[model samples]
Target: MMRRHPSHLRLKPLAKQVIVITGATSGIGLSTARAAAARGAALVLAARNEDALKAVAEDLSSKGAEVAFVAADVGREADVRAIAAVAVSRFGGFDTWVNNAGVTIVGPAEQTSLDDQRRLFDTNYWGVVYGSLAAIDQFQNQAGGGALINVGAGDVALPLQAAFFASKHAVKGFTDALRTELMAAHAPVSVTLIKPSGADTPGKDNARNLTGAPIAHPAGIYATPLVAQAILYAAEHRTRELTVGSGGRLLALASQVAPALTDPLLAIGARLNARIAKAPDPARIDNLHHAGRDLRERSFQPGVRETSLYATAQMKPKTTLGLMAAAALAAGFAFKLGARKAAPIDE
Candidate 1:
């Protein structure tokens, strides 16, 4: 069993807190930055692109937000430390640090080169490690401690993106272990692992696609803001983990309940993913080796869900569960009545 802290923890409100977010130039990171700023939070943003970071800082600053940015890659320890240094220099210190910087490779695990796999780990896994340590050190010395939020994917592994899935699994392990250590020591920090489902972010477009075809998320995709909301909620509240969409929660459940059935379904989904691509881009550029240039948050995918009832349930479990159970019972009763009516009269 995991140990619990002896003391009560208190986190600051968004308007009065200083938040540091890595990978702030685009996607969920950018969306989180925007939402935090809107809530009157002072922001410290980090990303590989200096120009894009500057542009984001300026835009947020124009709206009367106290925003600072550092151009640092989280994969490097020194660079990750620099992000903390700027946060201290600009706003005294940060209340929440989000390790959201990551890159993906869309191809078979065997076909992926050893060098490419290492590079992906450098950004995805090592990046989270470095940021988590940095945030822990700062929080340990501070009065209120802090929130450490790591953006991870759904727990289930996908067929085409093995490397990415492996990295996420590593992140989940690290985050959980760190949370346990913090609790044992009676630390005030709140560590949260955010497992989002297929989000309509630019990640697919930014991925290193070696399959010679356009790639897309194989499952239901939710809007970036849904994930941003979860991140921000973790910033203010203490939660062990939060899944952003119902699809992610369902996949996790299925994987545990029926792995034998789930494996074949995932394989079918992988093949369907390739077929669903409208066309392949001949000049597509991936950010696996370099800084991403695009700053757009949304992928503009059709059928993007704007909200998630499952996500709401994660934040408020008892009430949502009660509502969901009642709805399920009603549906089951209706189905039973319909089946009885359709029975043969001779019976």
Candidate 2:
């Protein structure tokens, strides 16, 4: 029972418009699926897990959602084509497509294998590429413009997640190019890039299944319900870029105005993270998804503080800073407690 305020409900995009959502088995995609169903939109859910997809479709159907689902590894072209086929066969045709299925392997580039990194790109980056092509085809045939919503992240240059960040950076550049081309030629397809911060969802738990480990960062920062509400609003508004998390949007803004300063700031973060990092065995696949879940810790939003330029001088006093640092050490130890049990997945 996810209860939303009246304002949170999206307008039913007319029965003429069908929508397809990838990564719909969980997380942001799952939340969006539920929201879209609530709005009376015909739906198509895509994910690699067949059982999970079926379950989601059934749940939505019980709620009177005109939903169908397909299980496919988005990394493959034929599979993605089949996903679009499922949408067409079940719902007639699609008016919107969301590229939301993704994966992340977080660690130093040196320790992460090129093979594994490429696999991540195959899904995170290429998966979206395939979706856009399909959507463009449908929109071109349908007359007016339809939307393609892409899932992105705030940390385009974060050090710890080379593959993940690289895929997102590629999405940023790809969307830019796609939007430009559409505008230049007057193509009837619209693109929206969604950059959201840590969404509290099934992403980390699912990633653990792939890498057989846990993430090196806390997952609760996402405020999933809030982000989900934002996505629906973005769709109705046809927003070009939507940064949901307040802190995350600020970080993105700072990165733009002062690249030189932000570079060093991240460099400092990387160094601190590395120095404090307890390296997992590079060879351990059975326990190698996201760093054993010991990365859990809460980060305050710090409120609407002064600009980043003024942030350094305004930091907490040295005595308090030292005490906070000591607490971080203790919190880091408490992180180990979160690894108490493995996440259960039907797959």
Candidate 3:
């Protein structure tokens, strides 16, 4: 079980919240469903896999969770809309909508075909777009305000998965813009972007593999439950953004502070990490063309990180910011000292 932050205890009970989760058949989405179910929240699960969806829904329902399943592809706007319809028709209007359905491709940018790139965006980018719109419309029409949570990446770029990273960047930008609009209108809607780093999930295995070499999740990966914690947190409390994993936070920070240096480092790290974490080929049955292959709640690998720094950061933002500021200052001082020592002596 993942550790819950102090703030998590402060949020109102989720017993009455009608929560809608896309891609709920596996990974973080399925984990979030389990978390929310434990909290007594009514749920509507959406995914392309009918059998997997039914199995999850039944399992949750048997466990006393008010859960229902909708077999729909998030890539299609109509399917996304249908998901919302199911949420309302079954559990009443959903109080939170999680746009977590996404897919990625593994390969160099140039090597990835335009068709594959476009298809990736269709699920990763367009899926969030459609789900967000539907949730926004529902929230605007309803009496009570609602939360719209979209899962993005901590680092805007990930080596070897250029198209996937680009789509995540798009999601971040789109969500930021939508939040601005909501604030400007004084809308009672909370738009949150959850940025999780690599987690032990079947996502890596399910991604379309264009790379001839085997790929795997890097070391220091976090468990999927940590992300589920963030998702459930967002479902209750309003947050602008929450980034999961310390490694992810560090990479995001480095990218922001020193992009030129960080890019090359990330490229090298990504390549080396993949090579080190190579896994046996599961027949390379990628989910680019469709879904339903590796239906799993967690990946085969056990994530190293036990607790989430993201959760702690979310609860104590000011303290975390102060610590980050101190670290930055210390690093700056060290760099200055190094430069001064390297300078030629006047004598």
Candidate 4:
């Protein structure tokens, strides 16, 4: 549970903020770098790929955005600390840190190797833990507090990617607990979790595919810019959690209200989606062991529609919550009506 803070809290302007982002070479992290830089924020980009980091830094620099790069793996605590160290060295103290580095293993829980599962948690869960701790420490030492944002997936258990979903849930749980602790301590730092639904990114090819099937992000895929928008918003303002897309939002609600129904539905979807009979070469296809350097903007998959549900929901929380509740009520009422029509008439 994210604790809401007073609206009067002061935050530094985007132009003056020194932001550090992990997994900055590609996907949401890369998009976030571009967005934040355009806002005049100084950026420190970190990833395991040195060449890709240089390319991103050069591109941002050419566009006159203050930027630096650190080639480090988020899975290592020392490397994560080095990212903060670079921010201080280049831009003199970081104001916002986005822990966006994560990986996935596409396969059933039984089929996915234990080593692979542990690796997923190391990057998804432990990476956030390490980055948050570093950012909080820096915020405590500084005069003004800062924002710590963790880019997490929707908080729902899905099929085929059991470990990946579990890792995401762990991230949410850890983030909530950290928020509670920070509030109790009266710390000025703000922690936020940004959960984006399926987006068309290289993540499909970037992950370890143990299922021996072609894997891709779920339907209703939105572009990465939408997620970057939410990330930038949370950086300048205080946000508890932001879920980005109607598809993800609906799935989360379904999982919460009807897990029995959603469980099998999700399983069936995953099984059917994994029907592509080709397998990716583990050594060349996966970035689980090392950093991947194929950095690009979008995956460009066909037949998927985009949405702005997340951005709208972020801008209007009360309206969004009310609409979601109204939808639930409408669904219940329709079910009752159908039941009445099916029942034997009293004659």
Candidate 5:
């Protein structure tokens, strides 16, 4: 059983808050940093690339945002601690911490190297563990509790990215367990998990590709900023989890309601992914073992959706649920009326 907090918990507005974001050099983290800074929040950015971190910090600072950068790898517990330490030293303490560093391998589970898989877990799973612990500890000592945001992939797992999906599953489990423990302790902290579908981010480009050909999500690619919006929303709101795309939510629902059918469809989708024809670049340096050079938020994928109604609904669940219920009632009434009209007059 979990106990509620003794009193109401209030989160600071964006302009008055300080945020710490790991993996801030690219993808959702970079986009979130920009969004938060634009909203007048001071930021502490962390990533493996000191130069790129400096560039991002300089850019945000030049725009009149209070920003700091730390070149720390989240895979190492000590380095993760250093990130929190910098937030404490620079901004007195961070109001939110976003664990957004992750890496993936594109291939069959058997084809990928064990070392690579372990390394991916190091950054994805263990990194979240370290960041969550550090943030929780800091929040306990602070005046008001803070938010911990863990970025996870969609709930439905895909074929080629087995290890990556497994890491995300672990992240979800750990986050849930931690949230329960915090509630049991009556702690004034919010833990949120951000589940994003295929997004047009450098992650796919930076992934280790053991497959002979390139790999991408089969469908439903969303813009990186959309995911950033979800993350920032979680920071200010006490959301348990937010799936960034409707496609992802539907797939997750399908898998839960009918895995037998969904499994075969996923297997067929795997075949289509294998036939994409694009070859992996021999010279491209994958970010699994090192930092990626490309720091941009968006990838080259076209037709990236800029918005998600499902994501918007998640932010306002009660109203959305009421609207959905009303629509269902109206549809049922219309169906009955049409059925009566089509029936013969002699009852």
Candidate 6:
């Protein structure tokens, strides 16, 4: 039902407008890439995974989407610069660049490693910094207006994942200031910030770099298709700021209404999660593909099919009531299943 937006949307004037995506090897990056590709955008995928990048490119190419990729780690300035270069070389220049490369660090602050803290800044925060600078310079060079979108998480904050939260918070602040600076100077290129909840991503397993805390909540059988869709829509519309997930919106609300109350509560959650939450240890986690224990085991509905990220965004006045009813039934059914599983073990 989502018709193509017209050639103007696709071409965006001049030659094919390139789309640059960091952390394009997996998770929301990969999914978002697919969405953009479907919309007829040429892609310049950036990631540390050369083989994976090739595979994605080939797969998408087979489907008739023009794609190219670079093996660059956004954590490093040089690597990020190279990534931008690849995009310019391959497609001339990008119309949109997505800063999505990031890592998660979970656990208590006391136990978190300095190495992880550094990496968190490197990938989660500095990655955005490096990517932004790279994109801005390219936009300036091309003398063309483009966009920079930084993929974010949760709300403005989350106590348990202090390091992770800090990284995102840093991004949010940096982006807000950058947005204002650009506007003040009247730069044609735009900046956007995408705040999504813990999505259904392989990043959950790879993010186990922290032995102390967790980087994110595990994804279950049901994924946040709507959130993913929101990112794509935001990209199309060139929206400045976006928040995904009901929980994410609620967290924003909580932060505003009662910071004092939320702060202590978050601190308590952080403390408890440090000892509990028995997720993967830093050593056990890998950046490569690894799906952790199924979050769906607790809440999966047998007959319900997953809603695609694209579908998730389509639920408006037209689709809201149906979604809510289905969600309510799903919650109750999931509880019933959980109780049944627990009762036998208790016996």
TM-scores, in order shown? Answer: 0.91, 0.71, 0.86, 0.86, 0.91, 0.73
Model 5: how far residue 59 lies from native, Å: 1.2
Can you write out model 5's per-residue Cα lDDT over 205-269, one digit (the tens) per residue? 78898877777645558998899999888888888999998888889899999999999999998
Q: What is the lDDT of residue 174 in candidate 4?
A: 91
Q: State the displacement of the C-alpha of residue 160, model 4, in Å, after optimal TM-score superposition.
A: 1.2
Model 6: colliding residue pairs: 106-213, 106-214, 107-212, 107-213, 107-214, 220-296, 221-296, 225-309, 226-312
Candidate 4 on 111-197: residue-level lDDT in tens?
888888888888989999999999988887776778999988876767777898899889899999998898877777888999888
lDDT per model, in order?
0.90, 0.66, 0.83, 0.84, 0.89, 0.68
Backbone collisions counted per model: 0, 4, 0, 0, 0, 9
The superposed Cα distance between candidate 5 and the true structure at residue 28, in angstroms, equals 0.9
Residues 37-151, model 3: lDDT tens digits: 9999999999988988888888989999888889999999999999999888886688899999888788888999999999889888999999999998887777666889999
* Prediction 4 global C-alpha lDDT: 0.84
Instruction: Determine which window of 10 residues in candidate 3 has minimal summed lDDT.
Output: 1-10
Candidate 3 residues lying further than 4 Å off, grouped into runs, are 1-12, 316-347
Give lDDT tens digits, candidate 6, residues 1-347: 12222222322521245788887766777777777787787899988878788888898899889998998877889999998888888778788788988777555577777776887788888889999998877765664467788887766566546788888889998999998887665566667788765566655456544444544343332344444466556555656776655556666688899988888887776556545334554455365223222211112223222554423544343477777889999999999999998885544
Off by over 4 Å in 2: 1-16, 208-220, 256-347
Better of 2 and 3 by lDDT: 3
